[model samples]
Target: MGEDDDGGREVYGKMRAAAALRQIPRPPPTTFQEDLMEHLPAAIYTLLSCWTRFYQIGKNNHVVWDEAHFGKFGSYYLRREFYFDVHPPLGKMLVGLVGLLSGYNGHFEFKSGDEYKEDVPYVAMRVMLATFGVLMVPLAWYTAKELGFSNRAAHLTTIMVLCDVAWLCISRFILLDSMLLFFTVLTVFCLTRFHTERHDPFSPDWWVWLTFTGISIGCVASVKWVGLFVTALVGVYTLEDLWEKFGDLRMRKRDYINHWLARGLMLIGMPLFIYMMSFKLHFIILNHSGPGDAQMSSLFQANLEGNDFSKNPLEVAYGSKITLKNMGFGGGLLHSHVQTYPVGSQQQQVTCYHYKDDNNNWRVEKPWTLPKVDDAGEIEFLKHGDIVRLQHTPTNRNLHSHNVVAPVSKLNNEVSCYGNATAGDAGDHWQVEIVDDLVFGKREKVPRVRSLTTKLRFRHVLSSCYLVAPNSVLPPWGFKQIEVSCDKQNNPSDPHSHWNVESHWNGRLPVGETKFYKSPFLRDFWHLNVAMMTSNNALVPDADKEDILASSPTDWPWMHLGLRMCGWGDNQTKYYLIGNPAVWWSSTLSLGICVIVIAVYLARMQRGYRDWGVGEWDHFLYVCKIAGLGWFFQYVPFLIMGRVTYIHHYLPTLYFAVLMVGHLFDHFVFKSRRLKDTTKWVIFGIATGIVIGVFWWFRGVAFGIDGPIKEHWGLLWRKSWNIYESH
Candidate 1:
């Protein structure tokens, strides 16, 4: 009786399984129409983006705003000449590549407001750069889809990106902003792709997306230092992800170790390799010496073609023609010009210049009143405590100082070139005080000054002042060079007071060995990166002078002001960089809405209200974290940055805010069960209409305005915008 009962139960279970299997329906085959419909939104956005970015791109043939700068950098690349700039090389390399493909020979100087010559190919280059902007709309749409947004939310994201006027204006010109924006969006997109493959970790697809994410990180950072903000976002996300895995009790020790190894190799190691490779390529391409040679170390400049540092004498001696260089970080060559100071002693101006020229050459000679050294006499090596006069080789003026105040540094005495070769006074004397020696060690009784190694200071014999070149820049009359003054107080620790013989020439001494001047690639790389950061940080606003175009970071999100991209002359074509009000205001509002919504949800959860399923709650938190944190990382740093910022600096941050808008719409209206599908579609339509209408209304500000500015009165939606010419 027991065997019969068991048989009956097994038969009943088999019958139930067969019935369930028969009830399951097969998926329908994908058709061409269905696939086209699926991709139609991105395709449409791409088309619109191309239209907005490329339409009348060449209407203004004159170099506009930063095009004067970035276009010249591209020319430098094509000419294979080294030039120094605060930005990294990848974006400029791309610009050069565009010029090469368009048949530009790097002949055009691209002076601001200068009309492009017939052979410059400015239009084609602009068109190529605008392609990056053209791809941005589709990238945003696809990124939204990867983040699990509904179709309605994805479409809204695409429209918002497409309709932003400032993004459009920046892309249509020759600048790095477009490339920076594209790479930033690409990084986020790749990150979302990597996240979706977490369930199948260590698989081929997972590794591919992860590697792509790393490459994108490298590419973005190589364009600008601002790219680090997005990199930081990626870093935070990775840390959170690894922390979650660490908390998983089911994970094996070997698997966890493997995860750490993989991330270290692919994320940190790969991006660093890519960044270093860009600098390596930059050094290779720019082998010729150009205007920026003085900005680099003497050793690094020695390796460049056309540089004469390799031919320099090994040691400094009396009667040697030399250029003195400040040993401070990012310092320049001690220079003097024929122009006299408008204020102070009214003598020939002494300054620090970052370019190699005849003005930088000075001859080390005995005090003007002393007997001239014989040519055939035994060489008198310049040593510690030597009294000498640095005669301006071009003008034959002795380096002199007086009690008159300096033009910039008022506390310091004025340093100028006074007496000529024949005329002389006691003020012409300078005592050479050796600080230390890099090669020969500390000061010796007969210590010879080694070129490029021995640090020295010139003290005014009569005034007891140390000649110094501080970081203070002179006024426009002095060509905006670093100010040179005579310090009344002695300070051995100040690098600004330190000087070294950078370039020496004497018939008596032999050329230095190449081994002595070899600068390692890693050291040069580190030095250049630090110098760039230092220079970038020095770009703060001046309280004494007003810059009409400058705006505070607080003024960005609210659209308080807009920038005039070029001249406002009635005869010239112009562009105004302002955002579409509907998009910027709504996106900013979404940030506040996000904070309130998260708080309310947490309160409800505390009260035991289950508003969402487990998977839904997790998804909501994930998307919100990426959007909020991405915005935070990109924007909050600007508040503390000492550098002067423009509205365009906020462009990358705006992308994250726009993402928040899409996520909120998906969670509250589109995908929510509380909202009907008809209501969701209606709301999406109204939002899209507002965005498109505002963009159309302000489209001329980007596409280019012809004729008089007074004709385009409605372009200034905000009262503070400088779009209109002053009456």
Candidate 2:
């Protein structure tokens, strides 16, 4: 009886222990382990990057290809000169800040192909970029771990990134791409963390991850518009997360509303605020006028101290010396000189030039006589329907247009300056018609000509055509400025035909609102975004120009092309941007493997053959789906973009591909039930060996080791693998 009681009690105790284990939640890692994992990858990445990125970063001692463009922008920022770029301002601002902190004097011109002076301190800037690049590897690794990959898998992904030649090249230079990549990976990592904490909805940890994800979204997007893809990814993920919460039977109605409110504020509101803040800082810092002033409105330019528009507003009169500006997008000041278009008609070429030269100035005179001051002591303003002659100030020739076809537009009447005996003839006379509403109080019959506010159209009296600035470039004879012609059909609403007086020399009218004009941040933000979009759209390659290193998106997946970042001579120091062939091929093949595995898994499910529990497989699929979406979003969009793209553009996509490969290897090979341990080890070993060996072979290219082009060609006999042949 005593033995039976003892056995029964032992069995009861075992059952109770099992029940307790099922009830308790799986706890997170200890703080010490988390710290070790985070710092270990970071330390390794930093050490590797420092050696590869800084060893001979300044060997060439001259400006690399794109450094000229971005370096000048940094100088402009230090000098407080406003400029425009197709990308957002944060990356350039950061570069400029680093240059400033490093004691760079902002005096270098940084012109294309110009050798940097020995004292330029370009290495400091290169190191700053390298730091950002170094962070990308660890960020990718951390992101993989957050998305459920094991430490080995995460470290493998980091190794793939560190070995990529393209990533190395971009990181070792002074470019915005490295910073962009860093922010993109950081954003993904934050969003992944937020996704992982969804079980504890509305908790402080949940809000922290969500908030940081929003901040990362803003940061990434501020680097380049391409970051919008990551933003879209976050947005979609957020929606899905909230939908999942709504469907949960345990979630109360109030909890659902709270979830929506919290996410809306953090994800949408925070990023928008941060994005606008970047632009606000940009406008505040760049106070003086610079090369990009011509692209802005006259009012905005007037706010700058040194711009020509900052002068006192001039009175409008018949004989006023004025510069007429085409209101069309990217139009310039109406200009003409003694030079004629060499091709068609051969008349003196009339074009719109952006610069402030004497050739761009003209005298507005009445066809009959110069006007006098009115009884109110105000100069007689040029009114609508008044016939006038625009005399070139430097050449003393009248603006003339006839039925002759323009050099750019064969159907339009060519505009030119006539200096012969008929300089003041009726053919030179044009009717000035005001197109804007007169808004400077009532009784402004002759609309008070405000510099940017007033718009006018000049109709040729003889040719019955309206003077217009088409978006065509004139020939070399015309200094390659925008073509000015007269179209037969006049559209009052056409911006190309509208003219604004950019600079006037009347000494009577007082300048208004020069210092008091404070444009709202929202308005400026909108204008800047529009300008960036327009500039990006205009980046198509010219068919007449030959770019030997230009590549197509098709060449990116196969790693078939390379870009020459810089070179001193054929046999001297050179940097060619390309990736390790073995890694690229293997990662691409892994993508194919992912497709096959997903297909097989689905087929097995259809056949009612379950390999894992429903919950576990669902979680695994979620991770893979997010990573696959990231890869697709980063790459497939480039295929449709019409602008000029290069192999460097594929680096972001390559990052996700590496992660995808790591995930597949961990889940399919290491965790597989069917595959033997020996088979898995063999496959892993072969891939690792190829990657490391190929990277070693190409280390010379990334490290800037000087070698002859012929020798490199011999080393890489395959045409597609030869980096020198790409250029």
Of the candidates shown, which would achieve the greatest lDDT relative to the real structure?
1
For model 2, how does the per-residue alpha-carbon lDDT over 1-727 read when each residue is reduced to its tens digit? 7655775666766764553343323347669887886778778876876777677787776787788888888898999998888898988999899889778989999876667776677888889878888888778777877777766577677778878877888888778988989988888899888877776777889899999998988888888888888887787777876776655544589989988899889988888888888988888889998877765555566677677665646446765788887777666678998887786667677888766678988887767444432334646677777788888988888899988888888888999988642345677889988787323433245455655556789999988899998667654455557789999987877888988787777666566444454445665677567656755665666677776667889898788877777763665677778888876777788778888888999999899997775355766677777777888888888889977888888887887778788888889776678889889778777767777778888877777757666665434635765455534
Cα deviation at 71, candidate 1, in Å, is 0.8
- Model number with the top TM-score: 1
Lowest lDDT block of 10, candidate 1: 19-28
lDDT of 1 by residue, 1-727 (tens): 7655775656766764553343313225569997788689888889989888989899998999999999999999999999999998899999999999999999899999999999999999999999999989999998998888989999999899999998999999999999999999999999998887887789998999999999999999999989989988899989888886776555698999989899888889888998899899998999898877788767678788887777788878888999998877677889999999999779899999878889999999998677886768888888888899889999999899988999989999999998898887888899999988766677773368878778888899999999898767776688767889999999988888999888899988898853355667887787678667756765777766788888888998899988888988889898888899988999999999999999999999999998975367778888998899999999999999977899999999999999999999998899888888899999999999999999999999899998999887777677787777562
Q: Candidate 1, TM-score vs. the true structure? A: 0.85
Steric clash pairs (candidate 1): none
How many residue pairs in model 1 have overlapping backbones? 0
Clashes of each: 0, 0
